[model samples]
Target: MNALKHSLAGLAAALLLAGCGALPDKPARAALYDFGPGSTPTATAGAAAPRALPMIALAEVDANSRLDGTQLLYRLGYADSNELRPYGQSRWSQPPAQLLRQRLREALSAGHTVLGPEESATIARTEGRLPDTLRVTLEEFSQYFEAPDRSVGLVRVSATLTRSQPGGDKVLAQRSFTARKPAPTQDGPGGVKALAASSDAVVAELVAWVDAPR
Candidate 1:
């Protein structure tokens, strides 16, 4: 009777285990966006025209990644740094791509004529490219840690700005802007936030340069 009872108990435990599914691992949180170029100012309808409007062509921006194997998609986070050591958990948040498109649209519309405007159809038909324009491309963006103390970041951007006829394809004005900012704090989020702010500064400078007089 005792042996029979033990066998029944083992069978009950096995059945219970089979009913429960395996637990899943924790999700990997991503922190992206927070880099370069904030929102653009609104433009009034039928606003007074400036001296000249430039047709601008904006290319895609790029960045380095710490987590993902590919560099195409990356979040705002820390890479191995010389000055600062890793601390705490790695946590990140990224904005949608639509935000970038909106920012670019706003920035360009502020003081320049963006490409593909219905009113500017004549301009495009006349000139192949815009005048006094900028094309921004991000080359190297990463955060460096100062061991046991602080952190810093470097943002390298390349911009091709020019002035020429719509279809002439000539270069009038061009320059490149590089900005570096030291981390405000050692905390992970704080450091990442600072870098993101620096990125915006870089973009703003690029826009201003493109719009400035040659």
Candidate 2:
């Protein structure tokens, strides 16, 4: 009995050691990125900086369910327009919608009191005035493959500006903006850089368009 017990203990110890050795290594961490222009804005030669429109509330940006996540998405080719793919080890710092909304808010805040939906309620209560509404829907935001080794970053968005009204909301203006930037390296890093540029360009255009005369 003693001999059998000692053999069983020795076998258990060997099995434990082998299990530890067979454990797999940790996965490679995903790389995270954000949008940026990477330089200070140059002063424009103009009169006094135009005053921001009273106040603008940015509504929650709507997007396709797949694009709402942080995963970096890509397309195989134009032939597969409806098919989307995600990179295994690339991701945004935050979900794409949040990132896009934050960028829009920052750009608009340059001269306006940009508020989220929750914050806009306070304005209505305190001032008896509801601010103008800015609604955006992301159409496409991903890296596209033109060929086996060629790609570009593509971004498309639709924006609508609505004014407060007695009976109902009035759409002052709305437009769609699309931008594409060719990747320099045809890989994850290049895609991220190109996407950032496209994002920056569309944001600037959207802000200007929303404030323009109809």
Candidate 3:
């Protein structure tokens, strides 16, 4: 009878000790944000919209490069399940084709001429960050996806700009912009947010370049 009582007491003590050693539950992860074309442009109070200046009409880049659209290509996604063939699956934060179309529309909107899907528009000016005009290419596009929040993207563009004059079309400018984004904490949403941030840099630089006196 005494042994049974002792065992019961010991079991109760063990339960209490186990309860004391238990860990608290972790916080639930938040739902990430994923904007379609990244975040929308924000205009500050008293700040005027970008000037719509005259420029050359842009031509569609050739398909020599592995770009999905005009000048947009995304690095492949990571597949957690496949440890061996890690790159077996690719998950794009945004569709490269769609993103390029949106970005091109936005960039051209800043200029004097309107951009459209049709090729009827006269060639006002050609603008891209590729190495060659007729055969521009996007060399490197690196992306990193992280946990708990955010994604970082590094875009390297190389292009050749060709302009059409009375004399004929000629190559104007060619260069690359290595746009980088700091860590974002919103998972899928974070990528778009980061893209918007990165796009801002590109737009600012392009604006200054176009605004500069020829």
Candidate 4:
């Protein structure tokens, strides 16, 4: 009976060891991604200072609840376009609105003096003059799959430009912008690259629109 008990214990110990070996030490973590570093100056050495650009007060970008999270979302046109799904192992480093705002600010900085809403208000109080206020609303941002293997990164936004006056603020311009870029692959990384490209395109359009005579 003692020998039998010893044998059963040994078998149990071996099974325990086998089970431990089969299990992973830690669960896999989701990959985090963001828009890549924007355009870099060609040469900093002896480079001329950039000319003064128009100053504009950029308000915080707004978005719907669906885009307020870090989940990397996608839609299947072939299956059910209305149902948005999240990738299992991928996520944005920040919410889509924040990411778009950062990218837009960076791009606009190249040709404008971008200021926050609070900063603009302070300047208005001190200088008695306010720069035009720009408000943006993110309407759509996602990877859209037309077919099982074909996809594109899609983005849409609405922009409103307003000027402050003694009486009240006046709307100067309002427009909607959309951009789509084909994904290099049908995976998360590819979606990220495509979205970044689409965002850059949209930013360029916004800068041009703002710079145009108003």
Clash counts for the predictions, in order: 21, 0, 19, 0
Ranking by lDDT, best first?
4, 2, 1, 3
Per-candidate TM vs. native?
A: 0.58, 0.81, 0.50, 0.91
Predicted model with the maximum TM-score: 4
Model 4: ten consecutive residues of lowest lDDT: 43-52
For residues 4-51, write the lDDT of model 3, one tens digit per residue. Answer: 999999999999989988967776644432225444668789987667
Best by lDDT: 4
Which 10-residue window of candidate 3 scores lowest in summed lDDT?
81-90
Pairing residues by index, what is the TM-score of model 3?
A: 0.50
Give stretches of model 3 more than 4 Å off.
1-52, 61-94, 116-137, 145-151, 186-189
Candidate 2 lDDT over residue span 111-192, tens digit each: 7888889888888888888899999999899998888678888999998889878898998888899989888877788889
How high is the CA lDDT of each candidate model?
0.54, 0.86, 0.47, 0.91
Q: Write the per-residue lDDT of candidate 4 for residues 93-200, one digit (tens) a residue.
A: 999889989988987887789999889989899998799988999999999999989999999999999998889989999999999999999999999988988888
Give stretches of model 1 more than 4 Å off.
1-37, 40-55, 60-104, 116-123, 126-130, 166-168, 184-188
lDDT of 4: 0.91
| Candidate order, TM-score descending | 4, 2, 1, 3
With a 3 Å backbone cut-off (N, CA, C), the pairs that clash in candidate 2 are: none
How far does residue 174 in candidate 4 sit from its true spot (Å)? Answer: 0.9
Clash count in backbone of candidate 1: 21
